[model samples]
Target: MNKISRKGFLKIAAAAAMSGVTAGALAACNAASSSTAASSGAAGSYTPGTYTGTAEGISSTVKVTMTFSDSAVTDVVVDTSGETASYGAAAAEELKNQLLNAGSDEIDGVSGSTITSDAVKKAAKSCFAQAKGEATVTSVQLPTGDETDWLGEEPDIDEAAITETVDTDIVIVGAGNGGMFAAAYAAAKGLNFRVIEQNGNVQDTRHWVGAVDGFGAQEQGIKMDRAKLLSEVSRYASGKCDQRVVKTWINESAEMIEFVRSIMEDKYGVKMIYTYGDEAKWPAENAEHNTDYMYPEIEYTYDRSSGAARNELLLQYIQELGYDVDFKTSLAKLEKNSDGRITGIIAQSTEDDHFIRYNANKGVLLACGGFPGNPYMMEQLDPLGTSVTTACSYSPSDKGYGIRAAMWAGANLDKEAAPMLFDRGVVAPGVDGGYVDSDTAFGGKAFPGTIRQYNPGTQPFLKVNRNGERFANESSPYNDIVYAAAHQPGRVYAQICDANILEDAKRFHTIGCSAQTRNAGEAYVQGKMDEAIAAGALFKCDTLEELADKLGFTGEAKDTFLATVDRYNELYDKQNDEDFGKPAYRLSAIRTAPFYGCWLGASLLTTEQGIAINEKGQALDNDNKPMPGLYITGDMSGSFFANNYPCLMAGVAMGRTLTFAMKAVKQMAGLE
Candidate 1:
């Protein structure tokens, strides 16, 4: 054996191809004694030696030193100094154990600390390849960007360059679901109004909508204790929410939703149905849950996922009242009078490239959704740039034009955390990857799979990060799994399965969408898996060792991957999961050959961070005082969520949007 410098590994890349690692891993003649500190079966290209290497991690850089003699790793030292020492400490400990178990540079990444784990693997590989006199080293670069990109510089266009003007008592910006409701109430109140919609029509891209809140529709005869509802929401808001505003949200949701329902059903005969899925129903009778979170029942507009809803109905009602809206028109800015009061609005026609001004005699309301389509806004809210992961929020890239118009006009904005979630979906076939079951990732469209087809991709089967380490409880709900994935090294995870896993999902009582319907046959599901594997959405390998290597596992990762499967199989045999407690039925072992996997990025519904508002639905400034002549509704205001979407509040975003629209309409029209 020959001694080499740290850089020696990089020097041998071309030379090591003649004797590749794992070339004869299983031969009996390869055995070496423990005294030699080498592989018991001295079969691969390790070349018996010690070496060191370095790699980048989540929050820091990591250095690794390894001792491999006779093709078997005998010792490992991980230096995770770059990762805020405390957080990296535990990760280092976990990585050491994983490395020792595999006795080779093929092992699992630490679940909670993927960045450090990746660093360890890369570092180990440097040593292994160098020891083998090989120069080739695998590198896994993390995806990068400011995870939050929604907040950016305000629009720079001058407002004085107005080309046209329309004077009205009330001017509404945006024609989405929330804006439409405000428009209808203004129309009903006989207030002079004009609506500027960026899209050609009232289009909303939400498939699921509904909320179970405190005060439901009184006329519908299902109401909760208003006081309790108010207190609950106020608590949920964590003192960050205006108690008064929360109270109004609780008091008005039912009436607003019911009123819209009445207008749509009684007049048009259109019906609302409960959206069915994982989030469809409220929490059941269980100790870990309460009833109030179950109060406000959620229902969806029948059929069309992106079709008619309350807002669409409200748009019709506004038209019935003889109010006309400008399609393809966008709000450019809001002008204030010398007294600090909102006076008028400037807008542009997307169709003709022309600007129009609307003088507001009474007020101007901005109900465009939270800056979902603005990358600058995302950058501000989520510095990690996770928004770029998938097409969860697919609104027109108006870059939050309406929200900025409000902010520029002296309206206050809330800088709270907004977490995007993937309700369901799969890695799209073509482009990088996306949620296929719930969201469209590639080409702005979803794949052709019935719930039974793509649902298997999302079911809570065993999963691991890029380092081949199980990072979460595979049986947990969508939110838990997603939260884990978001914090991983690359903010990504792989759902592990053998070729037979799909068949097991079909044959056994798998949870998630599978519990709702029978999956496609085993062959069909395998075919789908193979297709995803070919597209790189999913990885396939003849052996687990290959799977571990492809995922960037090193040292003990490969051994741990096999051991993990064996241990999980033992757990499955006993019908109990001790490691993660994944429900027994979901505990199928990864035994079959030609293993498969789908890489899942975090999924999101929509982003709803926005301008703060008062109980009166008036836009508030930094001082928490309402900005006169301005109001926000829909996704534009009343988002009190701290992080994850409130569980059991299916469609609460739409609920709040509609509720605030009603209140904002009343306030802007001076009816409050």
Candidate 2:
């Protein structure tokens, strides 16, 4: 690429500005993008029924359903195919609201997200023709700048109101694993730092992380093979994880582990338990709450403790080290100096909504969770994955404020978003206290169910789609039913298990299958699953054919399902699965009188995909260069994993969060 002269650059920028392109991410937009802005027509000019239309989004086609009565837009719903949950989801609702408020489709799109907003408008226009009406369509104003706000517009902040400013060497946002580690290490390094968290207490947050991979476990009698670990990580990440970042994590994890071990075991007297095999794997901490799989090294937990204990202990030590920390302090936004360094951060106190400006002389480290709590973002980011906003595993602090703020400040994001979709949860209704019945669990445009619900029928069973055919391996290597089920037809599937399996799940606590909760996996089994049957969540039948009918399987699909089960049983008897190659010991035939079954919707743990960041934890710009003073860590730096988060290196993200934050601090403090 040739560099343009200053005059040429200014002319081109002027041209873009003249075209109504505001402060938004200006990228290679689809030339064919459309919008439905009407100039001279009234909104109440169409027929009064539901109509469907489609528009292309950045990643996929968006299906929009527009409803009109008396020619006024009454309702607008959307299925944004592959649009990001972080941006498009909110765009859908906001666009709908705009249409309703304006009583027409002529409204301008939201700032920072002109493209997605235009798509919504275009789809609304598609419905106009069906109602015997026409709309004056328009095109989106494509941005020319690399940086844009959430609405895809360039941001212009006014810093006239300083209010308050506290000078600090380091400003850390969110007391998550990354933020906590940054605080500890910065204190240890004698850097003037303060940690700010949106959540008040450690326990109130979603800190239930699992596993921390590293070596030097002689005392715990666990040996780690670094080479094999790296290979496994590469395989699990499917070659998407940056090799530089992976190498750094693998090389430094042992030291991080030693830090944790010294504080956890030797100093704090926290018990470190090491277990072998995948017999009972839930958290890497060996605290089996049912659902088990093979992660021999991962199931290392503190003595009868969990992720919360680990953080609380770290917090204790940080406080003991006399570090300044503030809970319930949210990272509102970042302000950059002319040198492109993050000079200050605007934070809002969650308790009373008081604002404070933290003037950082050195740097600002951002690791404030992901966009799970934002309902629209959960859908837009991982459309193939279900998102019951009520069920995301975090507190109310997971709105992606930090990530979006960084983007607004010129940080780049990974459009190839990879949410952490796992197969460990239950589907409940979106409404308050409304449990999503098993039958209608997977029928939504997005992934269903509350995330990380308590051991919702964890033991892996033979899973089949609505077509009653097997898709992926039921178990092994984290083949999450959440992602699979979301893509399945009707987004619904059944977990078929025999009465014996359900009974065993209840009677004994086994791998990934917990009957501890009274109505859990094994507890709900009976000759007839009356409650779930009434709730349309479960079905029971004496014969396989009858079970199929009760669940609406017919013809070829029914036959294929029966054959799949028969062949599965055959493989079970032979003690070998030649098809998907599921381990024989873990395989169980779906055979038993009066078969027991329940509908399954996958769970959203924590999304690992976030903004793109370089090895030094600096958030990258559109050119893939580090945005000085604007650094990202934890899930906020999303380029680490792609496609899926593998179980191979369980708890590695948590470790990376700490290690990476410390690394960024070191770089800023000139200690590296």
Candidate 3:
């Protein structure tokens, strides 16, 4: 048997064809063993020998050799034929320990390696069966439920089966910003709640690259005006959002921010700093024009602080509250009584494949984030968002599991919210990954390049199709860039920019710059240009025509491309853009002696569509009514933002939603 690495396992498993095994029957195997032991002399007394069994989802084949004498296990040896490296090796070591310790067939499960443990147990069971001269292994009966009824009969409402069970006063799905806050809020109210995270860790990817801006919290005595903050967000959201929701978000934003600040300072002993030079502020002129009649009629204020620190602090606060939080446990199904009232939930731990039925005695809050990880779901939800790669590092488990599980529970589905979109700056191949608002990558130093070169926040640089023809407005907002990228041919690109424009980005690292602008500017300074050139981020040339030729733009289109650059430079000189309404300062002439173009591609972080919930954060059915005993929050509940850009601060919405749900539950229970 050969050893396999963890990376090798993940890479191989991505293409490995898996056959379904009966999880329920296997669960029954545990129960049957316990029952048989009660009826017989001793449950531990079983023959030990080498077993041959096939279990699905194991990265590689495992050979287990065991020796037993006097009805007691003596020694166990485990050799892997092929498996992922670290995880498989860890599991193999754990299996040897368990087999040796049990002294019998009834071995307790190992943590963080539950699924593998089950596989090893099954193989051991096979060995025991063979030693007993059994021709066929007995099948165990598993607990069953109505999956069809849970998912309903409608195609629009996507549903999935509930796999595990947990018992808690409240169950919050998703361990991202919102879900964590929900747990924290519940703890503040003295409620028992459990956060079920599908990922192995909390705040997986959604908040991993986050910059906790837009919250009206005061740090170092610098308080953001809450009303002004609300007004700003409303302007950004384009007045299409629910006013009540927006108001609630604004009003609560400050409290959550302060809450995070307190936790970071007091508990974690981490001083939250206010660094103000990384972002490009909204021009005073544009701010004045867009400030009035903003959709939610609120102003926006942002805290240029570390999103990772904020998230980590908040998670620590939740842990301090004594709430039970489990990671790698996925919600499999929602259980209900005959009256269609949600009674409990079935969840399975990816670690062990063990199902836990969580009885939500109060209510269930679905805070699982959006579904950018699932490509098929993205294409189905927003046909225009298909071309983008999930540029940021996020949770692999955030594949719409909670959304699907909720929809299966007869929840209302919001098709329009299926594909959440976000704008990501192009990272040249040799450069590090795309720039994050916070400096989680790059040692906390802002990327070095001017915003003029890469204004992903505003509009993407001129994107040329395979034939080098420009499509869509190059100066539109990031969302528009995403929409156009999806519609563009071949879904590929080379974004052209010049050195002068890159030099102008150096000012972005100074104080009072927006985090987004700072991130863009720093990309060049952080050796993004050189890195990208080395990594294939840029196609370089001595002349504009040569650059164009390298990019595959030929003939009439090449001439047109040059003409477009000239016209754009003219607009820059004149201080206005007639084509895309871009502000003059953002425009630049592309006639630098040495021209460079970086290949840019579209990507996403979360799915946009999810179960429909009302403004009060109640999970609604297809008829637009609340699902009894169920509430949804976070990305799993739709109708928040049109695209993904921290529409609201993480944890704020979840905090409020769960608080309100807790009150509603109390009222429902006649406790208040």
Candidate 4:
């Protein structure tokens, strides 16, 4: 066998037509034998051989490879590359060491990575079983079908196999921002509701919670043009979105914020702060009308971590109210009556795979998240999104199950896909942007590369395609760059800058989430850049030519890159952008030494389109009539957004989720 680089293995594994027990699996083993004895008395003897096993992880499959000898465990490798970066992926090394040191799968799990740790142990056990010749091969292959078939046939669950049943006034699917808020309001209204989530705890991935004309903005003396905001959102969606649903958020968002403040602050003693885009500003030359797209103060906790802190308190408050969020419970299917009214749902216990029936007397709210983590849905609904996206912040829980369940129950889905994209997914040289045909535990295409977050990529830098030609105005909305790059060569672009990046970013004054690094000061920003440089995610060189070569610009592409730089410098010197109509203040010449380059596509935060709904948060049928006793919220609900998520408002997505969650609960309780 020929020796292959790790990067080569990753690239090959992604595109390979993998069957049961793939060759990549054997190659990934690359095992080493050891005679080291077990440290604990429980360490049992094993046959001398290399073995591999796999199990389901937080987002994808976790594979374990082990080499064993009589009375000892030798070398071990845990492949957690598919897991969440901050949690499961980070726990890989520790889990590997634990397996080797203990000589058994019974080892302590890493903190905050329980799911991955459990998967590692399970896979390790299977490896040990294989080493012992116990005939236990535990790897399961994902389902595959025609490329265009994302909504496969509905599951034919056996009714007699259900182990138990429960009754409730309201049944809420998911314990994310939408479901949690719905539960909080339900508890307050004295409604007996059950909230079910597949994950072990609540999901809080974002911080900002946008609202229009909320008390926080009022206290700060900030005002908004309702009509202008409405028109801007309509324009963003190309008028495909339901204006009535958009208007509902515009009208009730203030009330939602106050309700959040009441629970987080008045009840839980967690102080919240509301902020407008004060830290970022457009150039003075750009008229005030250009700033009309900005939002008023949005609510947030004290810091990034505080968002989760407040959520923990909210969970405690719900538990104290004699209600509980059922974790490790996955939705199976929606159960409806013959009258076309949703009656309840069938949920599977993630721990035991046993099915349980939940009967909702009032209504059922589907706040389960979108399909950013589900590759099947991405391939079918948003192939362009799947191609350009490299990373996802969503979890395995967001498998588009809620949306599919609604569709199976006669709900109509949005004809167009709406994905919330950010210009931050950083790739390395030679990696083209496209969907990788890797088979995952969740049936979808995997990202082609190991991408990192290039937050500063949000700055309006001089971006060029593989042919080294300037593509578009980088100062536009985040998703616009991704869409534009889709039409470019290799479906990827390189962001080029110079040593004056710190000062340039400060002057760029990009608003919304882009302003985060700019506000963090030069030191923080430089530190991040340095870290990226150290990680080989960024290319830094003394000359533009060297930078171009490092970024994969060859021959004519290199010359074009040099010419593009010179032309960009000319524009910067003239303080005008004639090609793309970019604001002059945002232009920064790439003349300084020690140039930097990073290949980018887009990072997916979540998908924004799903089952179509009305202003009342009720799912709509094919005839545009509301589906009785069925409500939708969070990313699972659509019609308020159509094409791309409007990130200019910071937390509009979460705000819309919470606002409509309240609407759904109230509507079910007869208060609407």
Which prediction has the highest lDDT against the true structure?
Answer: 4
Cα-based TM-score, every candidate: 0.63, 0.66, 0.64, 0.78
Report the C-alpha lDDT of model 2 over 76-111, residue by residue, as the tens digit: 666664665666656766777676676555778777
User: In TM-score terms, which candidate is top?
Assistant: 4
Write the residue-wise lDDT of candidate 3 on 161-203 in tens digits: 2243456777777667677666666666677678877655666
The true-structure Cα RMSD of candidate 3 reads 11.1
In terms of lDDT, the poorest run of 10 residues in model 1 is 19-28
Weakest ten-residue segment in model 3 by summed lDDT: 8-17
Poorest lDDT segment (10 consecutive residues) of candidate 2: 5-14
What's each prediction's clash count?
A: 56, 41, 76, 2
The lDDT of model 3 is 0.49
Quality of model 2 by C-alpha lDDT: 0.58
User: In candidate 2, residue 23 scores what lDDT?
Assistant: 17
Better of 2 and 3 by lDDT: 2
